[model samples]
Target: MGLAKQQEQKILYISPLSLGDVEFQERNLGLPVRAVNQEEFIERVFGHFKGHLCVFLKRADGTPSNTFYKHSEKERMYKYLQTTFGINTYVSYSTFYQKVKKHKSDILRTQSNIVHTYMLVQDLDYYKFGMTDAECLQKIGQMVAKGELICPTFIVSTGQGYQLIWLLEPFKNIAGYTNDLDWRRIQDHMYEQLKELNSDSVVKNPSAVTRLPGSRHNKTKNLVYGFLANEVTFTLQDFLWFYDIVPVADRSVKPKKLNKKKATVTTIVKNWNEYTLNKQREEDIFIFVNVQNERGKSYIGIRNWLALVLRFHALVSSDNDTEYAEKRVKELCEIMDMSETDEEEILRRSLPAETYYKQWIEDTWDRNKYLRGGLFYTNSRMLELMDAKEDYYIQWKMKTIKIKNAKYEAARKRFEKYGEEEADKHTWEAFQERRNEKLASDKADKLWQLEEALDRHPEWTNKQLMEHLGWSLRTIQNYKKKLHK
Candidate 1:
């Protein structure tokens, strides 16, 4: 028969734990052998004979020792296998010890007994067949190209001493294990090889490799590429680059609908023109009287006077002779400080040529023209000035609230000193006295000044008169009524 097909040879190796040198009593010979600590001895003994034993060694009761051992001892043992036996030996540590303990018997039974070692060695040899530096680098580069290892991974070295390094991305994982060694050497070699491979082509292209599509990546090409043609020098450019790369989602933005209701510009302009014409007529009536008094002219310009009169009546008539017209006329008379005769003259000039004062009055009063819209058809500027006055009044009212509150508080305190009935009687008498005093003082100090203004500017209309006196229409009217009375 052809030489018995050599049974596929398999080897089992086990490492002893906590061994020491001992002198045997019977042989009087010093022998260095494998011994395990008492705690580990049971597991080690079972590991040796559990597998087919081509060779085996055991040491018992060798020396008193703890788990700690010298590095020299470990190295010496490792050296024995590598140098004398031409075998690679891996020293088992705590991690390997735990692994062996879990599968104690299975490892021993399946393996051949060629190696002269215990159960621990058989278990640890499984991981000892690790990849070399070159093989490890190749795997890391492949992982990076596939985008499997974008983050850092670790590597360990068994030569010289136990060392570890963390491999970062870009240069691949092998750069980590290089420690202090120059990795640029490896990089240079790789670059040269890549260049040689592309030498035949005018346009050098990267080799095809699988990678997840980055936000900046072109999926159409299976090659590495850069977003920038050159390096960025400015800080703003870096920000712009990052911003451009960020993905933006589409969203619907609707335009807002405006009011778009056109204002009544034509109506406003027409009303404004009419208001100006009426105001001019009022001014002419005042001016004509002033001229007559100053020049000692007995006769008036009838046409000019009648024209002014018609304009005034038209304005008053258009307002339907509303209550506001009466009020405005009263304010005008008070502001202008005109005598009854002077008022009569102005009204006469404003009336129709055929109509007498009595009939005009009857017609105006009967038709209730003064009770209609009144001066509502006035200029927008006048309305704006009125609105400003209203705002000032509101502000004054707000200010008065604080003053009133303080006065009330003081009154309350004063009243508390007297009985409630006596306090009410005294407070009312005092309030009346204070009011009379204030009224009298206000007329002398403020109303006199307004009167002087009216006397000096007899030609002014109500609005113009109020402006000259720097007073409100209401204030001027009140003072005029008091002065006339």
Candidate 2:
């Protein structure tokens, strides 16, 4: 015998006319040209059909409802497909799939045994009031004949929450079995199922019921669950949808208030300028010395050079509001008796302020000695040249020289009085001698105290004797040895 083969049914998909275009055509206006192909037409019909069914049917329990208008998961999936295949294929697939998924739950629910009693009654009443009682009964009978009865079972165990089980008819006419079926009938059936399911209670017997793991409703729930478990990839559409839901806070986007206590560089410069302007003075020496003291240089010449550089810088910027950098340079050159060429050379050699100061100090120190007029010299001729308080200058010089001489003398005496090895040996000997002398004095005092303690407590043992005097065994023995000697 040969196996019987089922014939494939060929369904002709009619593309849906736009409501606006249909209205225009009814008024005898020219209609828009239809640009869709057979495949595109089929896809559009299927998508619309699926969407209609989905809207009518209730979303399966345990699956999250689509609260936001923009589908985040679908968008991400579409992008992934586009990257993998091609943009055209991704667009076609995404458009069709998105429409189908929208009404998938509704269609599946209509096929199940779970009929919504509320919608059924409502529809029956509508027909009765709109038409005749006979028409209402006739419609009701037709629905009952085509409808599948679903026995829903819910279970709750020790740990697990209530689980729902829906027992559906093996074969029945779903809401939209054929394209000829009325959409109103389909919606009524779906609503009826929802109402019935809501009224259903959990079943007690766990063994009697056979559990079908992956039903249409369960599969839909699982698909949604998996999608949510993965991170959601948001698009611009998603952001707009979010904005509609929750608005951003004003304070969050606002700039922070700045601290009032802080002072800027501009303020510091302004204050310094004002102070300088207030302290206007007559002709100052403006001595310009190149303070260069580094790499084997005299401290005296370096100090003088530093003084000159500092004075030159001060004089140039002394005007406060106005800068006299050029004038200061000319005055500095005149004071130093430097020619134009020399001045240019010096300016070129000096890089940054710190580098200039360093080089100047180093150069001055290298050529000079500690003369009586230098910074190191208390009674130097340079100090006499400057018109300042003689007493104050004298005092400062004396103090500085005294400190310097003391330090020098100390270092010199240490070297001359003792050789390296002898110095270390003498230091150690002195320390040891002082330690021994202190120890001897303590011992003598303790001996006298011990004698008095013994006289007061004659019955004391050696341990008790040592304990009372806070002496160790070795110390007590040594004291006894000294007594014997």
Candidate 3:
């Protein structure tokens, strides 16, 4: 990870229930601030909005704790939280209770995995001689590269301190996950490793939650934002580094070096020409927009979201899958871990799939184009909006939730005065303007990239260059003629 993305706004959640209330605690991010789940919390941690979300409450002794309440009791917990205080529902970093196995006396022990790996965004209160944020980051970089320590996936500047969020790519790096008890052991191992570097012991427990990026620090009066979403995502080796895992080196990543005078492939994007319905280009555009691969990422609700995206494509392109889209969508969703009843019941047939699709496509692909997001960035952006993270069925407002587009103008406009009348009225207009600019900018970016490629390999023909750059011969000719002039 190069640099972790910072807080989207300057705001911290304040607990509604005081010490007397059942769910009240000293300091919680007032429950789910910006994250739909753990990954979003890690990616775009900060949001300024306030909502009633339940974080894991601590024990009476003030010790950090993680408790896996039963599925049947979740509704009861929700009602309790809400009736006592004005909270919406429970939002947790951990997974829903899953049965691991049966024990003696026919008892079932239910446990859920910690879905998101974390970095304590701490201000080093324990140490008298504390390091600056920059120094801490530098020291971490040095430590990881030494072939000794597990590298952090990203770093966040909390305004008060820094958070080195741990890396769990493809969601499998941290294995041997059985239940909450197992996770506590894992957390303890990690805490022990980082303790030498001044990791705070108080919040190191498995169930602890941090504020989203935009949440304000009441004490410091400062806001946190993305310090960096590291360009260097962790490998199995990095995770293994924690367990003292060895012998097998993780897959090597070739460094993508950019030319000093020109932008790199990471910065260049395809020009938005036209999306002609049913044409090969349309099909390609659909695939390009929807199916971009995000290497080494496995998050919750993946299959359901894919079904939604693919179903939208089927519905829009009547010639394709129009006959059995509903049936097929259920099938696809099932393959991705959803139950048949869930596909039918949870995903209501009467739901506005079209409006949802348009909203999603516009918010995501449109946002990505404007940000000049490349493949990985674009895919990551898409992941943030699926299912619960999406705004289609917005039950409660969040701090930051627009995938990776939180940094762009399209996202910023909504946040300017978020819940205000102006934000509501002007949001759509601003979005369309940004989309139009992206359409123009992408074409320009493409041409610029083409020219840089041509300049480096002068002897190459237009056809060869077209093959190299995945451009059409006509497009290449048009650009060449324009460049020649």
Which candidate number has the best TM-score?
3
Please give the CA lDDT of all the candidate structures. 0.29, 0.28, 0.39
Candidate 1 — what's its lDDT? 0.29
User: Which lDDT tens digits does candidate 1 get at residues 43-128?
Assistant: 22223222121111111333221121222343443343234221111221111111122453543211121121211110001113
RMSD of 2: 38.9
State candidate 1's TM-score.
0.14
TM-score of candidate 3 versus the correct structure, residues matched by position: 0.29
RMSD of each: 46.3, 38.9, 25.9
In the range 1-485, model 3's lDDT, one tens digit per residue, is: 22111111111112122322212111221121111222344333312212112344333355542334443444564454344232111123333223333544431211123333323233233233465554555555555445344444334445466555543332311232222223344455556666656776644443345443434444455654433323344322223223422112111211232122322222112422111221222232223223222222222223333444455444544433444446546555443433223666525531344553344334443331122211112322332332233331121222122233443444445645564345644566777998999988987898798889978999999889988999899988888887778
- After TM-score superposition, the amount by which residue 107's alpha carbon in candidate 3 deviates from its true location, in angstroms, is 19
- Model 3, position 33, has a per-residue lDDT of 16
On TM-score, the stronger of 2 and 3 is 3
Candidates' TM-scores? 0.14, 0.14, 0.29
lDDT leader? 3
Give the C-alpha miss distance for residue 408 in model 2, angstroms: 25
